[model samples]
Structure formats: C-alpha cells, structure tokens
Target chain A: MREIQAEEITSVVAEAIKNINFHIRPDVKAELQRALEEEASPLGRQSLQLLLENAQMAAAGVLPLCQDTGTTVIFAEVGQEVRIVGASLEEALQAGVRLATREGRLRHSIAVHPLSRGNSGDNTPAVVHYHPIPGKALKLFVMAKGGGCENASAMAMLPPLASRHGVGDYIVNIIRTNGAAACPPLIIGIGLGGNFETAPLLAKRALLRKIGEFSPDPETAKLEKVLLRRINELGIGPQGWGGSITALSVSIETAPCHIASLPVAVNVECHSHRLTEVKI
Target chain B: MSATWLKLPLEPLVLRDLKVGQWVNLSGSLYTARDAALKQIFDLEADNKQPPVDLKGQLIYFVGPTPPAPGESVGSAGPTTSRRMEHFIPALIEAGVSGIMGKGPLSQSTVKELQRKGIIYLAAAGGAGAFYGSKVRGATITAYEELGPEAIYCMHIENFPAVVAIDLEGGDLFEQGPKTYRKET
Candidate 1:
C-alpha cells in the first residue's frame, strides 16, 4: 500500500490552481494561433489577436487570464491501495483552494446562498468529485469554470430512439442561442448515453481532456468532427462577433445506459479553457 | 478597419457616428458595476434616497475585476455577461448614464431602450482580462466596499479596446455579424 500525506494534496492543489490561472494550456494557445491565422472577419481576427495577447500577458504574470478566477472544480481519482494521512481529502482540497485564492489574488466569486447572495470570502467548499481506482497512485484534475460558460451548460434525457443527428441539432441550437454570451470560440464537451445525472457529470469531465484530443472510438471521433464543422459554420466566431471558427474543438465522453433512455449533456467552456492535471 | 480613438462621457453625436462592427479604443474616466452594485443603486433609487455615485453622463462597465497583485492598479478586469444586468439597465439609462461596456448581446427590449435614450453599448473582449487590465491606469473603489470585487470602481483607462456592439441608432453587431458571416450549409 502507498501512503500519501494529506498536506501533499493541499500543496499540489494550491500550486495547480495558481498555475492553471496564470498559463493558458499550450494546445489551447496553438489552436488560438491557428484560428487567428484563418479567421476571415476583421473583428474576429482582432478578437483572436487580443485573446492571444491576453494569454501571453497572463503567462508573463502581469495579471490572471480572467477576472472570474472561477469556481474551483476538482476531480480526484484515488487508488484503493493508497491511504491519506492527517486531514480528510475534502478538507485538504478546500484548504488548498483557500490558500490559492488568498496568496494568488484570485477573485473570491463563491456566493454563500442563492437568494441572499452572500459572498464566500475565501472561495471555499470546492465542488470535488472522488473516484476509487485500482492503482496505488492518486490523480487530480482541476478546472476553473467561469460562471458565464457554466450558466450555458445543458442536459437532456431523450427518448431511446432519438437519432444522433437530433443530438447534434440540440447542441447547435444551444450554441446559436448562447451567441456571444458564453464567450465563443468555445471548447465543447459532450456526454452521451449515461443515466440522468451522470450525463452532465460526464460532459463536465470531458472538458478536462486536452483540447483537440478525440475519443478513441471511431464513431465518437467522427461525431466530434461533424459537430466542430457545423458549429464553426454557424459563424459565431471569437467573442461571437462572427467568423468561421465558433468552436476550437469538440470532445465527447460516453457511457452505457439503460435500454429506455438516451441521455446527453453539453458543457460549454469559454476560450480561456483553463484546466490542468497532476498525478502523485 | 482601423479603430477610432474616443474619450469617455461620449457625446451623442460621437456615439451616433459609431457603426455596429467598428472597433474602438476608449480612454478617460469610467465607472465599474455588476449585478450587486446595480441592485443597490436600484434599491436606493426606489427608496427615494441618494445613491452612492452619480450616474449622469457616466459610462458604466459591467465587470467584477480580480484583486490586483502587489504594485498593480487592478487585476484582470474583463467584461462579464451582460444579460444578467438587462433587468436593471433601463433604470440606469433613465438616470442619464451615457453608455455601457460589456460582453455579449443585449436583449431586444434593452436595445430599444438604448436607442430611445441615445445610449451606446460596447463589447470588450470577454476573456481577454489580462490585456484589458493592463490598459487600466488607475482604479479606486467609489461605493459598496462590502461587496468586494463587485463594488463600484471609478477607473482611469487608456486605450481600452472594444467594439461598438450596439450604436446609438440601435445597430446591433450580435445579430447582424452572424447573419453576414454565416455560411449556408
């Protein structure tokens, strides 16, 4: 059995939060550069150029990539053979989030209540998902999900007979209606064939994948390509001012479901597309 | 097209000259407010009480910036989604606010109100916070300090980049831009 200190988790989470906020993942940066070269609209090209410059400035530590440092979402995959020492996993992760927000100067965006609208000053009680795996190592996936894009996420439980084209239509409609509100040139994550709740979770998880990474399954990969083409064809472009590249990439994660249902969820991510992973 | 350089508290005539897709680099004084600050202003006005800041002829930015790092004027200050403020914007327009800077499209009703009021709506690059923050030369909290980042800040900005998403004549880029560029598939 592998023994891991809880403080190690806290330190790792803290550093990961700080790093992800400061740096745009290289793959996302590359895609933005490509989009900048290909964007036809003058406004779209300008927006992409500014986005690229923002990434550069953020990497230099001038300021964070976004003002919305985002609600910290952590996915922890813990092996059954590993035991956590000292504080519990949840406590450790929350401590790490509080540290990052305070030391890194991230925005404290969490509200204490929905209606009262109270601010959680330190941005605590992170939304964490835990999974038990067979190996001795622990893996952490962290994402700073902006409120604008999170508000745009959707899930539907369709009849089992719903066609794949119908699923594609729903996604297109959501993007069309969202327009510039969700920060276009978005990274789209799709979850298919899961149960009612898991579908959305799968979609959110799919976002943690590196941009441009496709599913190993041939059918799913083809669907990703088709959706990407159709979405860009909508001309939502960068910041939705209009161009040919509405989405940088489309990724899908699928699961087996009961015979009676075809559940799907779409989680839209803004151009910032901030996510990072670490294994310990 | 090259961007037009305009100073804030923009005159109606200057605003009228802006087209839907034109780029702009705005400078001079601007006030920042998002959902919380807007609500407070509305509540105070409803009670017939003095609000914290004067709105007449002022430009409001719908943003909640991150806290500045040491030696910086402000943190990454970027535009938030503007739809959430749609409920409260008409009141601000009635109060003589000249224009709004934000991201995303305004509702049709909001667009009509802006046109009637001769107000302008500008779109800042939404996620380009670091780049925008660098343009802000100074920031001071003007009201609602208790709201933290959501507080109203009077900011001095130089050459802040934006697009005229909605002009004084009710031209809207969000609606028209897509229609012009969309490929018939």
Candidate 2:
C-alpha cells in the first residue's frame, strides 16, 4: 500500500485554495474570452472586458478575483490501496484550508451557524465529499460557491412525459425569471435523468466541463447549442443592460432514471466560475 | 463632463443632476454593512434604540468582505446582492443613510425611499473585488465585531468607484435599462 503523509495532503489543499483565488484555470479564461468576441450588446462586451481585467488583476497581484471568495467545497477521490498517515484526513484538510485562508489572504465567509450567524475566522472545516475510487492516487477538486449564483440553483422532478423541449423551456424560463440576480453572462449546469438529489450533483459536476465544450452525445450537444443561442437572445446584456452574450455556456450530465420520473436540476454559476483540482 | 468628488458630513444634493451613465469617485467616511447588519439596525430602530453608527448622510456599503491577511487593509471588498437587503433599505433611508452601495437590482420600495429622502444607491462592479479593495485606505469596527465579516465596519475610502444606479428621482438603471432592451418575440 502506498502511504501518503497528512502534511502532504494539507499542502495540496493549501496550494489548490491559493491557486483558485488568484488564477482561474486556463480553459475557463479561454471561454470568457470567446464570449467577449461574440457579445452583441455593447454593455455585454464591456462587462466581459471588465471580467477579463478582474481575472488578470487578481492573477498578477495575487489577489482574490471576487469579493465573495465562496465556501470551499472539496471532492476527494481516495484510492483503495493507499493508507493515510500522520493525522486524520479531515483534520489535515481543514488545517490546509486554515493555512490557505491566512497565507492566500482569502475572505473568511463561512458563518458558524446557519441561524445565529458568525464567521469562522480561518474558513476551515471545508465541505468534503469523499469517494473511494479504484486507483493508487488521490484526486481532489475544490469549488468555491459565491452566494449570487449559488442562491439561484434549483431542482425539479418532472413526469416521464416531459420532453426535451419541455426541459429546455423550463431551463430558459428559470434563467429568464431569475434575470441578473444570478449574474448575467452566466454558466448553466443542467443534470437530467438522475434521482432527485443526485440530479443536482450531476448538474454541479457538469459545471467542471470545459467552457464552450460540447457534450459527446450528438443530441445533448445540440440541446446545449440551441439553449446557448436562445439565452443570449434574451438580451440581458452584460450586467443585465440588455445584450447578446447572456450565457457563457451550458453543460449537462445525465444518468438513467426510473421510468416514471424525469429529474432535472439547474445550477447557475456566475462569471467567476472559481474551481481548481489536484492529484496526489 | 467634469468629475466631482464629495466628502462626508454631506449636505442634500439634487438627484436631478445625476445622469444615467455618469461615473463617480466617492471619498470620506463610509460604513460597511449588508443584509444581516441592515436587519439588525432596523430592529434596533423598531425598539427605539439608537443604531450603532450615526447614519445621517452616512454612506453604507453593502459588503461583507473576507478577512484581510496580517498586513492588508481589507480583502476583496466587493458588493453583495442588493436585492437581499430590500426589506431593510426603506427603513435605513428613513433612518438617514444618504447612500447605499451594492450590486444588482433594488426593490421598488427602495427606489421610492431614495427619491423621498433625496438619497442615492450606487453599483460597484460585481466581481472587481481586488480593484475595489485598493481604494479602501482604513477601517475600524464600531459594532458587531462578533459577527466577523458581517460586522459593521467604519471605513475611510479614497476615490472609490461606482455608478449611480438609483438617483433621487426614483429612477433606477437596473429596471429601466433591462425593460428597454428585453427581447420581444
């Protein structure tokens, strides 16, 4: 069995947190740039330009891209043949987040209680989802969910008769109704055909797909393209000034569902789209 | 158009002069607060208790920034959603806050309140936290430090950037612009 020290995992988490704060991944950057080129609304183009500038400034100066640095969500895939040494894995991850919060100069947004409300100074005790995978290496993906777009996420279970057209209509309606509150030039993550809760998970997971990357399945890819065109047509321009580039991308993940159920989930992400990953 | 700057201890200014797209750089003493903090302030007002800060002509920033590291003045101090604070806003205006700074839409009631009180609401670019943080030169806690980032912080800013989202006439950029440009079938 391969043995990994607790300090090693802590270091990985620390670096991943720091990296996501300042530098958005390359694929994400490229997508935002592409949207800027196609944006029809002058205001939309301007908003995109500001977004690009924000990213550049954050990276060059080693500062946070958005004031809402978000709650740290960790998805870890642990290998079966590996043994954790030094300290409990959870504690090590929290320690890593604590170190990153201090060193990276990140915002501590996590509240101590949902009702009473108090900030956890270090941003520690990350939201961790662990899965045992068939591998000798551990992989972790960290997502920081800002409140603006995260508050707009929703899920609904439709009847089996809900057609692809119905699904499209539902999604478009939600985005239309939510408007700029979700932040225009948004990324929509749609999960279809899964159980209720898992549908949302699939939708969020789909967000990790490359910006503007089409699904491999022809039908799904066509849906993504059509939805992209329709949303931009809303003219919710950049910052909702009425524009052509309303949505940056739409990613969908699907799984088999019960014959009587059509579970759909929509997770909207702001232009910030902050996420990072590491394999150790 | 020439740019103008304002200092704290402000006197009432006509909202008529503020244009839809004009840029403004604000300075002087501003208080930091958001939804939770706003709610608390309103609750105190309801009980006839004095609020933590003297808000007459005071500028309240709708932000709950991240904790600054050991040596920085503040962390990405960007605006939070304005819609969430809608319920508390009219009361804040009634209580004498001259300005509110945040992003996104404001409630109709908020717009009305701004007009009635000759107040203003501004929008800072949503994601430009780093750029905005540079404008904050100093900060101090006047109340609710236990609330951490959500606490009411008295901040001194220099040349902070924002656009007039809601002027004294109840004209709101968010409502008017979107309605004009919304696509029709």
Candidate 3:
C-alpha cells in the first residue's frame, strides 16, 4: 500500500485552490479566444475581449478574476491502495482551503447560516465529494464555482419516456431564463439518468471536463453538440447584452438508473471557469 | 458607436435622455450597495430612520468587491447580478435614486415599476473584476462596515464603463437585444 501524508494533500490543495482563481484554464482560454473570433455581435466581441483581458490580468496576479471568488468544491478520487496519515481527509482539505482564502486574499463568500445571512469569513467548509478509484495516487478535482453560475443550475425528473427533444427543452428553458445572470458564454454540464441526487452530481462533475471534449458515449456526444447549438440560439450572448455564442461548450455524463426514473440536471458554469485536476 | 460619458449625481433630464444600447463611461461619485446593504436601507426606511448616507440624486452600483490587496484602494470590483436586488429599486427611486449600474436583466415587474420614471440602468462586464477595479480611484465604507464586501461604499470612480440596459421609457436592451440576434432554429 502507498502511504500519503495528510499534510501533503493539504499543501497540494492550498496551491491548487489559489492557482485556479488567478489563472484561466488553458482549454477554457483557447475556447474564449476562438469564441472571440466567431462571435457575430460587436458587443459580444467587446465583452469577450474584456473577458480575455481579465484572464490575462488575473494570471499576472494584478487581481483576482472576479470579486466573487465563490464556493470551493473538491472532488477527491482516492486510490484503493493508499492510506492517509496525520489528519482526517476533510480536516486536511479544510485547513489548506482556509490558508489559501487568507493568503490568496480571495473573497470569503459562503454564508454562515441561511437564516442569518452572515458571512462564513474564512470560506471554509467546501462542498467535497469522495470516490474510490483503482490507482496508487490520490486525485483531486477542484472548482471555484461562482455564485451567479451556480444560481443558474437546475435539476428535474422528466417522464421516464421523455424523448430526446423533451429533455433538451427542459435544460434549454432553464438557461433561457437564467443565463444572463450566470454570465456567458457559459460551460454547460448536463447529467442524465441515475437517481434524483446522483443526476445533479453527474452534471456538476461533468463541468470538470475540458472545453471541446465530448462524452465517451457516442449518443451522449451527439446530444452535447445539439444542446450547444440550441442554447447559443437563445441569444443570451456575453453578459446578456445579446448576440450569437451564448455557450462555449456543452458536456454530458450519464449513468444507469432504475427503469422507472429519468432524471436530468444542468450545471451552468460562467466564462470564468475556475477548475483544475491535481494528482498526488 | 461612440460612447457617452455620464457624470454622477445624475440629473433627471440626463437620465431621461439616456437610451438603451448606448455605451457610457461614468465619472465622479456613486454609492455601492448589494443584497445586504439594500435590505438594511429598506429596513431603515421602514422604520422611518435615515440610512447612513443621503441617497438622493445618486446612482447605486450593485457590487461586493474583494478587500484590497496591499497598497490598492479596493480589490477586484466587478458588478454583481442585479435582478436579486430588484425589490429595493422602487423604494430607492422614491428615496431619490436616479440610476443603477449592474449586470443582468431585471424582471418585468421591476422594469414596469421604473417606467416613465427616468431611471437609467447600466450593465457592466459581469465578472471582469480586475478591469473594473482599475477604474476605482477612491473608496470608503459609508455604512455597515461589519458587512465586509456587502457594505455600502462611497466610491469616487473615473470612466467606469457600462452599456445602458434600460432607459426612461421602459426600453430595455436586455429585452430587445436578444430578439434582434436570436436566430430561428
């Protein structure tokens, strides 16, 4: 068995969280560059330019990409052969996150309590998901999910017999109404099948897929293409000022489910897509 | 299209003349308030108490900026989503607010509330915080400092950019701009 120190995980997470807020993912940056060239609206072109510029400035450490640094969501894939020492996984991760929020000067955005509406101040208690994998090394998938885009996320249980068009329509309608606030062009992650809870999880996890990559499933890959075309037609454009190119990409992840259930989820991520993959 | 430069402490006539889809650069002072501060102001008004600052003739910017890095006046200061704060608009207008600047489209009911009232709405680049932060020349906590980023900040800004989203006669670029570009699919 391979043994990994909890401190090592903490250090890795600390840097990963801080790095993502400042640097645009290379794939996302390339997509934005391509979008700038293809965008039909003059206003969209301008907004895209500002977005690219913001990405550059942020990478240089002039400032963060956004004032709303957002909720920390970590998905950890632990190797079956690995054992952790010194601290609990959650404790290690939270300590690293707290350190980054302070040292990086990222915004402390999480609410202390829903009823109180008070700030959490440290931006701790990240939404973490753990999965067991077959490797000897630990993997962490981290995202600084923005509030605006998160507010745009939706989930529904369509009829088990719902057609391809029916499911697509439900996802498109959510973005049609909420896309403006989410910030565009957006990275659309869709989840299909599984139970009610897992559907949204699949969708949220789908966002970590790089822009331009499609589902491994042949049929799901086709749906991603179709959904991208339909959503862009909404004309939400960049910052909702209007134009062609509402979404940058659409990705889907699906799983087998009970025969009676058909669950769907859409996790909308904004132009400022802050995510990274780290192997330890 | 050439951009129009609008000064703060907006005049009623200027507010009426601003048209949807026009790009504008703003200079001078405005108050920054988002979800929490607006709620506080409304609550204060409900009790017939004065808000910490006089809001008359001022434009309210919906933003919650990051705390400044070393030697910076304010940290990344982009606009927040405006629709969430829609509830405070009418009362703020009644309190003499002339304009607002934020991102996203407000709901129809709120748009109707501002109809013929000469209330101008400006939409900034939503998450371009670093860009907007450069435009802020000065900032001071005007009220509710305990609220951190959501605190009301009186900012002296120069040439901050936005597009006029909704104009005096209930003309909204958000409503019209989409239809203009939406392709029949």
The models' CA-based lDDT, in order, is 0.90, 0.79, 0.89
Q: How accurate is candidate 2 locally (lDDT)?
A: 0.79
Per-residue lDDT, model 1, residue B37, is 95
lDDT of 3 by residue, A180-210 (tens): 8898999999999999899999999999898
Chain A vs. true chain A, TM-score per model, equals 0.98, 0.95, 0.98
**Residue range with the least summed lDDT across 10 consecutive positions in model 1 chain A:** A171-180
Over 4 Å off, model 1? none
**A34 Cα displacement, candidate 3 (Å):** 1.1
The regions of model 3 sitting more than 4 angstroms off are none
Give me the overall lDDT of model 3: 0.89
Native-to-model Cα distance after best TM-score fit, residue A115 in candidate 1, in Å: 1.6
The residue-by-residue lDDT of candidate 1 on A1-280, one tens digit each, is: 8988999999999999999898999999999999989988989998999998899899986589999999999999999999889999899899999999988899989999989989999998789999999989999999899999998889888888888899899888888888579988999999998898899999998898888889999999999999999898898788989888889999999999999999999999998988999999
Encode model 2's per-residue lDDT on A119-220: one tens digit a residue.
Answer: 688886688888899869888888877888888788899889988889888888878766577666788899998897789988888887878789999999
Angstrom error of the Cα, residue A215, model 3: value is: 1.0
Better of 1 and 2 by lDDT: 1
Q: What is the interface RMSD of candidate 3, in Å?
A: 1.2
Model 3 residue B48 lDDT score: 86
Ranking by lDDT: 1, 3, 2
**Candidate 1 docking DockQ:** 0.80
